[model samples]
Target chain A: LDAEAMAAARERHLTLTKPPGSLGRVEEVGARLAGICGECPPPVPESPAVLVCAGDHGVLARGVSPWPSEVTAAMVANFLSGGAAVNALARTVGGRVSVLDVGVAGDLPDHPLLRSAKVRRGTNDLSRGAAMSREEAARAVLAGAHLAEELVESGGADLLATGDMGIGNTTAAAALISSFTGRPARETTGRGTGIDDATLALKTRVVEEALELHAPDPKDPLGTLAALGGLEHAALSGVVLAGAALGVPVVLDGVVSNSAALVARALAPDAVGYLFAGHRSAEPGASVALEALGLDPLLDLGMRLGEGTGALLAVPVVGGAARVLSEMATFSDAGIEG
Target chain B: LDAEAMAAARERHLTLTKPPGSLGRVEEVGARLAGICGECPPPVPESPAVLVCAGDHGVLARGVSPWPSEVTAAMVANFLSGGAAVNALARTVGGRVSVLDVGVAGDLPDHPLLRSAKVRRGTNDLSRGAAMSREEAARAVLAGAHLAEELVESGGADLLATGDMGIGNTTAAAALISSFTGRPARETTGRGTGIDDATLALKTRVVEEALELHAPDPKDPLGTLAALGGLEHAALSGVVLAGAALGVPVVLDGVVSNSAALVARALAPDAVGYLFAGHRSAEPGASVALEALGLDPLLDLGMRLGEGTGALLAVPVVGGAARVLSEMATFSDAGIEG
Candidate 1:
């Protein structure tokens, strides 16, 4: 990863057979990897792991979503049954999808995809109390990072991506973003699931009230995160830490993930380099969060439906970038009169 | 597939997990395959084959490209070296990339990726005469199809995507699109490798003139394709036919590919349903070609670099769709109170 290593990696990439610079961004990633790993062709992870964190938000009682709190548990049931879109996408990509019960109000039955790691059934409603104690928040973050680290250290995964399942979590994300960036609540809240104008306006007001009450300190990033973080956010931040520590790629999906990454970067600025922004979420906070983190989203489809869908879609792009670096032709080896 | 078989396949898809109608077009593809093959969880190909056809256009002699015809050979060198972006992507996706020399004018050195099956050194300039005689055209199409059939029936490839490597081939595609759609050449021509306004004007005029000379009969798509087809076009048409005969998937890449698919559909309309438009090309004619074939493009990224970059990006999407159908939960299994 040093200058000498990077230059050597670049030389190896330039020696591959193809037109110089024909593979574009893909070649750059390959060369960067070669330099970092100090190998001609670094092995792409044959096994990728996805960590899905589930939680409940106290803000659910505030009527931010049209769907009831029970929908979160219901969808979790769907995920456990291997019926969620994420399951299918993971299977298609030959990656394993595991669900962790970071926190949820309802009791979750034992099932294959479900990983019972609840921090507490749910965080305290931020409008009324500290969402979670700083100690509990740190535990949730460590839990996420630990799971990913276990997979990588066991040689069970080459890379990791974080997925989330929660109701009113968008409110949690908006609150976290507002706290972290010192942005107004209105700037960070949007129609989470096609909410009507009147409901959106009301939701914004509620967020604004919460922001006013919390008045979280931006200088203390983790403190702000813990004060307003959903259990899933903490877990995702952990996934990012694990990826960075293990020197593996971690794809961050949507708003909840973006917030987690913002916190992760606060903890370790170098961690941002290990992350790939899969796509821009329809959530208003996503852009602000990504901007704060300084990352460009790979896809933009006005998609708000989370459950790791956008991240899953961007998997190929990530894979493609790596592939280009590993396989593209250099100017000379291609045997052209260039 | 028979009516009963098709009905059973349809039943299988409707029963899979996630929402009943969430996956849209992917659901239809899954069902149709199930019906056609009469297998609920159809065995996916362990080895997917990508057939990249390389050819040269006589039109390049007219000074239409920023790079010389030699760049085609240079890129073929890249493909053989396993250094092309497509090569890397295919490796990442666990597939093999093969090159077919259908009609390059130059002699290529023996290499592993290159498969020599040239019908001629190159096609005749369409501006002066038909690109290939009808007999030669049929031979080329059948040759590509035979290779595809061999991959599935003998080489054990379950899925195949058609890619092309040829300079000046886009001009040939524009002429074919204009002839097939009865559209103006100006509307169909686009900058290849970001050509300047002056060169683009020349390319457009050349295509218009070629279309007038061919005066293709829309009712007879084969005749139209034969008049304007590059060697790769004829070969790609063959790939589509082979896929249809073998009942496998053939993902189409860009404009030249669109023209070939149009020709393939004319040969057998059922082929259209079997084909998936991988992505929309930045080339102006590609959309028209896609529309004429009545297919939906999965991704659009203003990519005109060709070499099947768009299709390579889409390999994961098709794989993901299949995974969703095979792995996701059915509503009955999730135990939700739906």
Candidate 2:
């Protein structure tokens, strides 16, 4: 972050025609954007793109979610065809949506927006043993970083968003969040897709047992992801790293992205500054992950949908913050004495 | 609220590809839209418009805000010229902005978007006496209602938003909030336009004394406005009523519009059903007013800029809520069994 530009943006905000400190988080967002771009008024991103990563979880066999594993690949098709909730929301915010198949159990047909870069055919059932090899986790992370680079470079995307789709990914997310934050599994686990109490108890036990078995170190983010994370989790963490490396602000969708952020920050501590939490997800683990990163989410609409829907909802707000600082006349410029 | 439509929308949500209730407030917002329009997948607001009402405050004479009274008309002109925060935000959300000069003290030239509807030059100092006559208060309400009607009927606005502008308006808003909700001045009053500790103390005292002096009844909203409200407040309340009457969801800006909603609900309790709190204002009174009306603000960006900027940020979310419900394919239709 540019310290001088941040200071300049803060000074500029106080001079705006509206009351000082009245725009609240909007001012903070604008200042942060300046810090990211190293300028007083950051460029408003015209080509905001959400990279939705779809994968399957072998843990679905444990009844973590009622939906089938094929649902992940099926939803990717829906995203390509523009018929999912994330698609509708991305359209509303004028954000470009693309699907990255990181690790799906089923094969998928190609589309204009689809990027096929599978790390593996999905992780093994983590409740019994390690989810994936450490090498595979590293490869997944690289896949995400490469895709984000392609989007920003070839696609001309100034703003990058991380999105996710998987049936039992939330269970894996809970395990990772608990491992990274040192929170109890009971504290991090939540009802993914409205599970029954019995199923939630089972999911909680699966995560608790898995964490105890894996004992992945938070300092070793790659090792942790290989033990308890879905392949897409590694990829999403890679996206966060890519956004920070490229100096483009990354919008986080929900728990999947939030948990991914924990890994991203661990891998590169300074990447936290480049990340923007889109909304507070209803999933308990998402909140834990956000808190662990010390990041305040922009929206808190209880959205847990992780196809970058929440992040897309916040793109306009992030863009608007910059627009406001650049477009609105300052009190001094407007010749109004403060 | 339409019970059948709401229920149908709720039923449709479970059938959607995402997890049950995972979309959180987005789902609730969609169901609420259905209830508002009496149909599942309510019409998305393609032509959302924000009606900004600008006025001057007699309370400015008491040092309520540091800025000059002329800034009100100046800001109104800025809004008209599309150089203000509200215009930029409205443009971001694809909403139209039009200013209503309900009570600005200075004269202004005509513009294509400006509606001349001045009720009076300004209100009297509320601590000294009534802010305006009962007739003036009535006229202000009618001014807001008439503009909302025109915007929807002729301007093709399916979504209506209430915005406000006035010098020293927060003092009046604080008083109105305190009077209507029976909250104390200390709880409702805040620093308007960045007032110092001394100014906040004085503003609180002014509101406390005025409430004691007038003893405005919450049940008599118009009487309350005459005694303790700014012209923009009364007119904003009128916009709320007009939106409800026309069955158009009303997006409320910050403190001014929030305070006005208290008056609108007092006038017509059913109007609360049509009200959508765009964002929680940094002003203490706005939250107090929202609490009194049982409104959960969609955004809490700490924004207190009153040119309807906060409300404009929420327009897309409101519009997207409907869009998601209408556009997303059902799980069964997408061949994904839940």
Winning candidate number (TM-score): 2
Give the lDDT of residue B186 in candidate 1. 92
Compute the lDDT of residue B128 as modeled in candidate 2. Answer: 96
TM-score of each: 0.84, 0.98
Q: Write the per-residue lDDT of candidate 2 for residues A58-103, one digit (tens) a residue.
A: 8988888877888898999889888899899988888899888989
Give the per-residue lDDT digits (tens) of candidate 1, residues B74-130: 788777877676787777677778788888888888987677888887788888788
| DockQ of predicted candidate 1 | 0.35
Distance from true position, residue A66, model 2, in Å?
A: 1.9
The TM-score of predicted model 2 comes to: 0.98
What's the count of clashing pairs in each model shown?
11, 0
Runs with alpha carbons beyond 4 Å of true place in candidate 2: none
Q: Is the docking of candidate 2 incorrect, acceptable, medium or high quality?
A: medium
